[model samples]
Each structure stands twice: as structure tokens, then as C-alpha cells.
Target: MNKRKISSLLAVTCITALIVSGCGGGSGKAEDKVVSEKDYEPYSKYESPVEFTIGRNTSHTNNLPKGDSIENNMATRYVESKVNVKAKVAWETDDMDQKLSLSMTTGELPDVMLVSRTIFNQLVDNDLIEDMTEVYEKTASEGVKNIYSSYGDLLLDQVKVDGKIMGLPMTNIGNQHQLLWIRKDWLDKVGGKLPQSVDDVWNLARTFVEKDASGTGKTIGFGMNQDAMNFSPIFAAYNAFPGQWIKKDGKVVYGSVQPEMKEALADLAEHYKEGLIDKQFAVRSDEEKEALVINGQAGMLFNPWWIGYTNYKDSIKQDPKAEWVAVSAPVDENGKFKTIRQDPVGGGIVVVRKGYPHPEAIMKSINLTTDFLYSLTDDAVQYKKEHASEGLTDHSRWNNEPTQIPMQVDYDDVLKRYYDDIMKADKAGSADGIQEDRVVSYEAYQEFKQKGTAVDANTYGEYLSRIEGQREANNPNLEVIPAGFYGTTETMKLKWANLQKMEQEMMLKIIMGQASIDAFDQFVSTWKKTGGDEITQEVEEMSSR
Candidate 1:
């Protein structure tokens, strides 16, 4: 035999010997024999544990078990025992941006880590991360593949670097558009019809402020965070979306500086002057705003679907009668609800270090988590029982856990299936159709029978998610305009933060009557002069590419 054939024969002989003896150092058993790398599967446990280090960012809001920490949590321990992969914490921090920057400067990156899109691009440009294209295709579970496919071609295409998969994006539900959250009880009390037009919205706000819809002596027509003046659904209603680059007249243009924005600003300024919006909202936090809804100080808000867990929950707790409902943002004369949809491409992505030997480990970890959390199987049932005390059943806490690109299923699809179960139960006139996955819906339905809206926080959140999905699923009037650009352009990197601060300051001043409406004209003039024009040109270049 030639030398090449002799080498191949010897390699085969070693593998066969290991299989027969079952004494190899590798994880594969005789039954799970892998003659080559292509035979590897994500769920295959290593006979001997493999260890790697990861960098983690944490927060108090994570609600990690009392004594458990980022380095030694239930999640880490579970993966170690089950997958035979031990992820030791190389570093942990709350301020990930600063720490990640420091790591990059020192050239001490972890084996695996999650990073923002900006940092991800930087890593790609420097060739610091591994090319996961082949391994991902070979090892990704059906569930993981399906989740990524659901993001649509645009999202998946956006993550590719030179047509090679460099990182795994943390996909978000694309249909998470803003909705107008109003106090249902207040609408009933004022005998108010659902606001159908921008003018109708203004009228309702004015009436709520003038007539005290909350029935409390102290009431505000609207509750909003500091950025709401510039970023809320109100701006979208007028097609004046800020912080978005939109294609106008076959060219990319900044939405904030558009003429439509001036009109939206005028309307918002009028509300500020009329005391329709809380005077202190310019300084308020989201938490404070939610508190206003809870304490009966505000009647209307523009928020996302998940408000049930916080704003609605607190409000319902304080006043059992305080019912809330979500409706689409008011429309224009053309009956178009001009809402600005987010760029389908998400921000967070998980990457493996260039030198790491085990890119497949990330895929394996993802598959295991997917099986534990999503699969409707006996394993998941057992997992639930095992970690019930640690709040494993509450998937919201899963975000805090260590894993690669946490969710392996589309969030909206998960909700849709739960909605299906709920609807099935309703039609059957029995709760048997309700599945374990529909925790919020199931819990809410049970409490709904005893106390109705008095203690229906979980149900309300799930209800809102389902209702919003149904509303947006086929609504032609809902204009789903994509942001022309998502990441920072070259000029933007130099001046965007300053420009945002100036815009926020100028808008707040105009709203508070400290500056004239004409200031907007000056602000736009300055904005274009100071890098905005260059940024637009850059965005045009990027879009063309």
C-alpha cells in the first residue's frame, strides 16, 4: 500500500480498537461511535468533561438564586452535569461594554462570549472570531434551525460576514411593535370611544386631563419616560419616527430631521402646553411611569406587549378595578397607522474565539437548553420538577442564565402555540387542552374564574401578546417600514451620541416652552452641518452594498 493509504488504515484501526475496547479518553461510547467529526451530535454527552471559560455580564434584576452567582449558578451546574461541558467564568461584570472594551484592548477575550452588534462587527473586521459556518450547519438542532428560519431571509442574511456565518445572532420577535395602552375602566367612565385618528387621540388626552378620568384629584393624561417625547408611538402615528434612517425619494434620510417630525413635535408641544402630558415626564424613568399607572396618576401609555409583567401587574395589584387594553396607534386621514418597525436584524450575537477548538460546544449548549425549555417531552417534564424551587418554570428568568443565544425558538411562535392551546380549551369548554407551555395563559384563566381582572396580571400580558399578534398579522393599514440602517455609520461613530443628546435636549426644551418651535428648524440645520449629511451618504453606501 502507498504511504497515504497505510496512514488511513492505521487511523481506522485505532478508532476501531477504541470502539471495541470502549477505553478511549474521548466522550464517544461504543454505541455512540464517531469515526469522524461529521458524526458528532449536540446532545452527545462527553464521557470525560471538557472545560472552557466564558465572560459574563450580570444584573440584580436577573433574580438569580439568593446565594447562587454568575460563576456558579444552577444553569452552569446543569450543563456541566448533563452535557459534560463545564463553562468556568473567566470574568463577570455588570458594565459589559466597558469590560469588553478592556478585554479587547488587552487581547484577553474569553473562549465564548456574547457581544453587541457594534462590537461583533469590530471583532469580524479584526478577524478575531471563529468562522462557525460549517459547524453550525452540521450540528445545529432542528429546533435551532427552525427558530433562525423564522427570522426570515433578511435577518439571517444580515448576520452573515462575507457570506460566512461568524456569529450567532440573538433573535428577537420582529412583531414587537409599539401599542397604545389605555385604561379600559377610564375609557368606560368617560364614555369615550376608542381613538381612531390623531385628532381623536389629542381630544381624548385633553378631556382626560381636564375632566380627571382617574377620578383622583391628582391625574395626568399621559405617563411616559424621558425619551417618550421623541421616541413614542405618537411620533410613529405622524410618520415622524426618530432614531431611524428611512428611505425617502430613493435615498436614505434621517427620520428625526424630516418635515413630518416637525409636525409631530408641534402636536407634542401642544400637549405639553395644555398639561395633557405630565409636566415631570421629561425627568421620569420607565419605572416611575409604570408607578403612575399603578397609583392612578396616569390614564394612557404607549408601551410594548410585555407591560403586563410590570406596569399592568402593579396597577391591578393596587386597584382590582383598573382594567387596561391595548389598541393600535391612531391613524392618519388615509386610515394608515404609520408605525415604524424595527430593523429585522437584532443586536446581540454570540461568538467563539478564533482559537477555540470547540465551536460545536456552543451549538450543543443551545440544543440542550432548547430540549429542556421548549420540547414537549418527558425530559422537559423531569427538568421542571428538578428545578421548580429555583424558578426554572419561569422562563423569563432564563434570560439570566448562561447559554449561547438564549432562545432556540421564535418567541412569537411560542406564544402562538400557547394561544392555540388557550383557544382550543375555550372551544372545548374544558381546560384540558391547555398545555404546560401556556403558563401565563393557564394561570390567568384559572384566576379569571375566581376574581376576574382583580388578579389577572399573567393573563393580561399573555392576552396582550396574542391580541397584538392577531392585530399585526394581517393589518395593511399598519405600515411596517424598516429602518434604513441599524448599526453606526463611519460619521455616526464620531458624532451620533452628541447629536442624540442635542436632539433630546432641544426637544425637551421646546416641549417645556423653554425654547420656541423655530428652534427645531435651527437644530435640523445644525444636525445636517455636523456629520448628519455624511452619515446619510454613508447609509446610502451601506444600503447599496
Candidate 2:
């Protein structure tokens, strides 16, 4: 974290024991740290508020201007007070593809937008988004630079197309660690220590499902069926990553057509026949599945780090005894685990509108947004500079409030450094040891390093949560995968599209036994014929860069 020797007029000497319980504290008490009724002028309330219309998508929460939401009230008000930039949501949570495509065709855009990698590429192709590279170079702080240094190559690899990195991609603090996410109460009733190895994991699942160890007749051992996310954790150890990696010679060769997929399928099919898997996962919607977890029908589930946050603040509100801990994501029989790194620039919770009046304003907004997140949590920056990476955090990301780090950097060494430092600082009681913007970041680092193992979930709500014996996330010494080249040549695009589609469809079918693994040979033949070969050649060329 960038240390500026905080010289603000608002400085108050923070107490150690006092700040420990930042959450679950009284809101209005003098001891309460919550910013309550502070008088301030908002940026959006300018004489003619510098209108910055933004576009976004929302599923879990409404992104539009809600009367009582923090975005509308606290954060928006905060932005106005601090930056003097009037920000308003123009459009949110509709078909983004259609909106962006129309905007491109019509030459109409908001000031900033949150678009997918594909949309970002299209904007680059059409010369839409202003380049933030120079802006970041000139105005960005050292803390922000640390973020870039960690994921800079990743952004270049995925978001940067045609020699320019267009938009600033949002990032996650950490994700993809295998979390067991098991019911703690059930374990107490079952009367046994946590499992240690793959065999132990299996035995626990079997006993929970068959013996009804938790005394909750409705609950089962492992609560998953067709969920690629939850189920993949257990199988990741045997050199078989969750879905498919499509690798050749040990580098991800897209496992759909690879022979190892047959192995994974056979294992899954056996579990399905044995009744260890969830019967309703196939039909359950996202919300329904979450219900299954809350209702205690399943003792274990799989999920990313964010889900853990909801468990504490949201889900636990309903079931207070429901101590959801993160168990390790399962490892393959050979003690192997893998994660398919997501493109840092692809997925994000926030996006700038395309037609906002000022491009630099968008850059500043992004910088501030990330900085705000990092400051509160302090993950991206801390992990960027930390060394001696070990351990995991006990707290959730929302609670820690660090600047978000993209998941692609989760297992990468570049980030482990930051994580290590943040934890050391937080545990040492020097909260201000780093920048204030990194609260979440430091918390995440500390959660993993200190308390991660203290709270393991049946589902992977947090990375450090332990299952029988394993932590939800992987710490295997693996190399970071290069970001896949987006927006290739026309022939390359067509062929790559066809090849990937064919591979995905065929792989799912083969895994479900709807198609035979033998179909792979046929797939290989068609892959070459359908421009897979050309795309491969193109990818090979791109990789050389």
C-alpha cells in the first residue's frame, strides 16, 4: 500500500481493540465508527451537476438509483463530497449486449460503461473507449501502480486488443480456492475430526449422506449434482480442473476432448449413481440452490469467496447457528488441483457508462473505485508487494474492504506478496501500516494468514475455510496461465468460435454419457476441418507476443 503519511484533518487515532469489531457495532454511538450525518457537499449537486450517465447490469441487487441504497445515498453522496463529480446511473441491468451493440452502431454512448470483454473488444474495434493507459501512467498513485504491476500483463493479454488496452477492467480480491462449505453443526453432531485427504473427503460425504450424522434427516453429505462450480472442487486434485482446460503437453489443452475427461466423468457418474450428489441441482435456479444451502438440505456446497460474505451478513441473519465455513476445494486423487484463471478485464461487478461526458472522469472514477475498494480491503496493493506468501484470511471480503484484485491473480505469485504483507500489518495491529484504502485487502490477507482455518465452510464461502482438512483455496506452486487472445482475425474468430463451441458441447455430452468419449476422435477431425487448426495457428502466433 502507498504510504502518504495520512495528513488529513479528519485523522483520528484508531484504537486496536476498538476497531477489531468494526462490524456488528452500534451505528450512532460515539464509539461507532460508521460515518453518521456528517455535513458535506456532494459532487452531483453542482450548479449544473456534471452529469455522468452510466450503464450497468444487476442480478443479485438493483444497480439503479434506489432511495436507500449506499450507491444512491452513501457512496454517491461520498463521491460528490470528495471528488466533486456528479455521477448518476443513466441505464442499468438490461440486455447489455444489445445496448452496447446499438450504441456502437448509432455512435451514441454514455460517459462510461461496464461492458464484457467482448463488448470492450468491440468498443476498441469501433474506437469507442478512450485509452486509460496514458491516464494511469500520468495520474495513478503508487498503490494503483502496484495493482497494475500485478495484473498489467493479464489486462494486456486479455483486454488489450489491436495494440491498446481499452477499458479498465474491474477485479476481485481472491477466488477459485476449493472450499468444502460444510455444515459445522452437523460435524459437531457427527462426532469426528475433519477429513484430511481425498479418501477422508469421500468418507465424510458418505457418512453424512448415509448415516444422517447431523441428525437433520433432510440434510445430505455432499449437496451438488450438475453444478460445475461446487463439484469441480473435489475433483481438481487429480490434475483435472473443474470444467475443462483444453491443454496440450500439460498446458491446459481444453479437457473436453482430452482423455482425462472420461476419467472425471466416470467418477462423477459413479457418485451420481451412489446418491452422494444433489438430485435437484440440475433444476434449481441460482436462488433455489442458495435456498437448498440455507434450508440445511445439504451439508456441503461449492461457491466462490463472495458467497461467504452473504453467509455472514445476509444468510446468517436467517440461521444464526448456521456457521458456514469454507472447506478446501477438493484435490484430485494424485493430490493435484487447478484453476482456470478468468480474464481480469472480462467480468466485473461495476462498469462505467460509455457516453459519460469526460473520459478522464471515467478514468478517475475507475481509479477511485478500485482505490476505494483496495483501501477498505487492501488486497490488490498489499498482495502486489507482499512476499513469503503463506496462510489465508478468516474474514469475508466485504468485511475487509480491500481494493479488489482480479481472480486471475489469485493463485499467481505476484499477488501472494501483497496478501502476505497485508496480513502481517493487520495482525500486528498497525491498521495504518498500509494505506487506509486497503481495509478489505488487508483483511483478506489476514483472514487467510491468521483466521482462515478457524472458520471452514461446507461450501467455499471463503478461501481459507477448511473442509475435513483442506483449505478452500489452492496454494500449489503453479504458473499463471497466459490470458487467451481475444478478438482474433475473422477466420480465426469463426474457427475459434466453432472449435470452442464444439468442444464445450461435446465435452458436456460426453461427460453426461449422452455421447461417448470416442466422439473425441471425430471432434478432433472436425476441429481441424472447422478452422480449429487455423485458430490454433493464430493463437500460437498471438502467444508469441
Q: Identify the leading candidate in terms of lDDT.
A: 1
Encode model 1's per-residue lDDT on 17-103: one tens digit a residue: 444543222233335423246425756677766656677675343565677665555555666667677766676688777787666
Looking at model 1, which ten-residue stretch has the lowest summed lDDT?
A: 1-10
Q: On residues 1-545, what C-alpha lDDT tens digit does candidate 2 reach at each position?
A: 01123212212212221234221121111242121121111111233233365555542333323243423433344335445555555455568878866655444455556676556555554444555554455544455556656654654445554554455555543344445666676677677556646667777778787777545586565555443545665555544543343446634244444555556656665665567766555556767766666665677766654455454323443454555555554554544445555545435423333222344444444444454434433533453234112111332222211111111112133244444555567568765676553454545444555644343432323332222223234356322343333334446544566666676666455545567657757877787777866666655555555
lDDT of 1: 0.67
Which window of ten consecutive residues has the lowest lDDT sum in model 2?
35-44
What's model 2's overall lDDT?
Answer: 0.48
**RMSD to native, candidate 1:** 8.6
Q: Model-by-model lDDT, in order?
A: 0.67, 0.48
- Give stretches of model 1 more than 4 Å off: 1-35, 59-74, 229-231, 285-288, 344-347, 375-378, 386-399, 402-409, 412-418, 429-435, 456-477
